[model samples]
Target: YHLAREKKGMSLRPPYRQPHHLASAISLIGGGTYPKPGEISLAHRGVLFLDELGEFSRKTLDMLRQPMESGEVTISRVKQTVTYPSSFTLIAATNPCPCGYYGSRERYCTCTPRQVTDYQLKVSGPILDRLDFVLSLKSSGLQEKAASETSAEIRHRIGCVRSLQHERYGSHSLNATVSYQQLERTAGFSEVQLQRIGIVCFEQKWSNRTQVKLLRLARTIADLQGSETMTDSAIQEAIEWRKLPNVLQGGEHLGPT
Candidate 1:
């Protein structure tokens, strides 16, 4: 038995498909014989999570570069092409190595350097650059109870930010979509703040896109503090958050320089 129904709201994708074959790519980004919307379209205006991101093919992952930047995907067919909205927040997770343990205090990574590089390369540089935030989480290494945040508490904070965004921008205009002009008009930064941000951007040798992403992130951090003005602290925090991992920086083995 089967029922046809539309599923709406945020989507969290579970890992699927080995090597992310051409069929898998088509299934996700669309362009099969029928030319239907893919998972990206299905997750429009929501979250599209790839739990085991590295398992997908480098070619398949590269296909996401355009959509993440444009927030839309165009599928070309022999006679017709279809464009689908893919404006979804991407959330990805992957192991540091094929063995699912790299740089872990608890377990040694058994994969060779080549193996590790191959695994990491599955997600291309262009795609990684498109990601707004790329963080590497390590084990907490605590057996006893430690202070932590509940999902509800985190959700409350997010809700507060959403309300603030809606109030400031009028009608839930997210900071992610807001232009530099809009951000400047809404949360204007002072001369001192701009100087500090400029110094950090120059020292870090960050790209123009990274600089823009930092501004957007800083604006969000300011909103989180219920502030109308962007502050140096907010900009610093955003810069810290965008720091690339050692592996991502020079594409070297995980060893001391």
Candidate 2:
């Protein structure tokens, strides 16, 4: 009721999506003919925050791929296939490695290269690709820093941007949720911008899906900056965010400090 009232005359609040730890699923298979439910369904309406994301089992995490894309979950029994709504915003956080110190200036990583590879491999490519955003959170090391801005201020900005998108798209979706056709029409990128993206795509060997995702992210960045124009800075940041996983796979590289 509250969500509907807040988003009056529109769709429900997008659900929050989070992943569960692998160890939590160990007791899921009790000696029974009927299968038990999982954590994904419970994270239906609000934030599904996955902490220490890489520790989850690959198979367990892989189960989320379809639902993440389709916004519905299906469980098949001998009698029938049941479906549930799974449209939720995913928010996940993870340390750089198992030792929790890979690429950290404050501490050294004790895990071997093989261990790091295995840990990272637990998170599949398709699953990672489904995530709309990936932000690396770092601690500022000071507890009593002056408050920069309250949530109200941030939400006000988001609301303004949201209103603009609603007026433009005539839908409840945000700029991030704009379709490819809408993006092509509404997001005006210059020839130079396209060329730069083309070069990056070719050089990085980005997939078609990734290319689309990059454009969408760039659009969002532009919106946040209150720029009607999609500048090189916006595109560059989007590309950097998308490329972090690939670079991390190769080896740690300098990022925002």
Candidate 3:
């Protein structure tokens, strides 16, 4: 795909790939007689925005699991094997339900409980677990606009936080990418805070992977606030951001986290 765009100009910026929802597994991931790089590989060091994420086939979506963990995708053909960098930040957007009004404050959800469950589960648990933030946003209807930080200001703040993380880890590693041992050592949570986290994890029945991600997220929240110590408030905020939308189980909302 990129080879076809080479004549345009050499771009120093990282590539961004946003394949359509109907893209097949072989197209989204690479496959050919000579095995070319796909959208994921082309998105290396940049963004892979999967709009209407649930519309994608499960097989194609699950194929991302390995590359997401290993920071690269491997394509093996009859003649040879090839690997391509795929350490891209994935951003996906989808509806709360089939009718897109499951938990809306305005519109009533027309979807049945079963329908909602099935639709939400289109993106599997393992994939959701790999994500750092999972937020449910409401439409900002024609309300009065409020003052907010400018893009440049927000970018500056993010840059500072990133610099801090790089300095702390002695590398380019951010909170989300640091080694678990390194993160735990510098997490800076109080004993009481740790106990609270333990209680929440048990109550939520969160996987070990989720628990690690929660800490990483909390660490980042703390860093963003210019706090050397991870506070209870940071942990709480992280928990809220990490919670999955109300998914039905046995005809009742499990309040998944």
20-107: candidate 2 lDDT, tens digit per residue: 4654542211111343334455445555667667777788767768867776676677866566565555666666678777666676
Better of 2 and 3 by TM-score: 3
Residue 194, model 1, lDDT: 67
Candidate 1 residue pairs that clash: none
For TM-score, candidate 1 versus 3, the one ahead is 3
Q: Kindly list the per-residue Cα lDDT of model 1 for residues 136-195, writing each as its tens digit.
A: 665554686765988899889998998888787786687888777887677677877767
Q: What local lDDT does model 3 show for residue 69?
A: 83
Superposed by TM-score, candidate 1 places the C-alpha of residue 228 at a distance from the truth, in angstroms, of 2.6
| Lowest lDDT block of 10, candidate 3 | 248-257
Q: Per-residue lDDT for 2 in model 3?
A: 59
RMSD to truth, every model: 5.5, 6.0, 4.0
TM-score of 3: 0.87
Which segments of candidate 1 are over 4 A away from where they belong?
1-23, 140-142, 247-257
lDDT of 3 by residue, 33-79 (tens): 86887888878788898888867877788998898888988889889
Cα lDDT for residue 38, model 3?
A: 83
Runs off by more than 4 Å, candidate 2: 1-20, 23-38, 137-139, 143-147, 249-257
